[model samples]
Target: MTATRAPQGQEETRAGLWARLGDRLIVGGATVGDHGRDGEIVGLHHGDGTPPYDVRWSDTGRVTLVFPGPDARVQHFAPHAGPSAVRQS
Candidate 1:
């Protein structure tokens, strides 16, 4: 629900985001929001009640989060490239 901007000339990488999320889940035992991808920590609500969060990428290349459950469905739209693929206009 809050937004923080990255430093100038600095950008977040997907691997870094994933690592951060993994570390947070492992250490904090709570969910977190991935600002880079706009994903939320849906919490583990299945076996251990730590439901896995889903990442939904938008057409504009932005990503969002989806809570776990029957409502959470993976929808693949396009193939995402690495940071190398992001070229400034």
Candidate 2:
């Protein structure tokens, strides 16, 4: 899965970036040996897939609100991305 990320050492995120339900989030670890963590975007607090997303972690199955940092990347696969895809908050 391809991801649009800032330059190798750059910290800023690409413009117009957002996520939705069913999207996969991969967060990089501090070191290369660490595989880091991944999760599914199960809830959208603003219904717009903005920050502070409710994520269900694949490793722990724990759901938590996430504010993605520079180390985090999202892989979206929302075919029907629009009003119908948004859930009532």
Candidate 3:
């Protein structure tokens, strides 16, 4: 998986990025070693899978945007699959 970022690491996100609905967002990329946040893509602000995705956090059930950041990456799982298996992108 590649990291998307604004030019010079600015806090801007470009539109048209593809994100599947229900995909998981893994924060910290294992650098935090299992303590990072885990969230699911619940909705999209844009229909075309753009940034600022609506994410429902697993640990807290808090819904928030999966904003552009260096510490986050997306993990996609097969449809109807159980939580035991996770397909990372």
The worst-scoring run of ten residues by lDDT in candidate 1 lies at 20-29
Highest TM-score among the candidates is held by which one?
2
Highest-scoring model, lDDT: 2
Candidate 3 positional error at 19, Å: 1.4
Q: What are the Cα lDDT values of the candidates? A: 0.32, 0.77, 0.69
Please provide, for model 2 over 31-61, each residue's C-alpha lDDT reduced to its tens digit, 9 standing for 90 to 100.
Answer: 9799999998888877655787888898999
Residues 17-59, candidate 3, lDDT per residue (tens digit)?
4465777877764654567888888888877666788988899
lDDT score, candidate 1, position 15: 25
Could you tell me every candidate's TM-score relative to the true structure?
0.20, 0.67, 0.58
> Model 1 segments beyond 4 Å from truth?
1-58, 71-89
Give the clashing pairs for model 3. none
**RMSD of candidate 2 to the true fold?**
11.4
> Tens digit of lDDT per residue, candidate 1, span 1-41?
88887765554333212221211121121345522322323
Taking all chains together, the TM-score of candidate 1 against the true structure is 0.20
Those runs of model 2 whose alpha carbons end farther than 4 Å from true positions after fitting are 1-16, 80-89
Q: Candidates 1 and 3: which is better by TM-score?
A: 3
Using lDDT as the measure, name the better of candidate 2 and candidate 3.
2
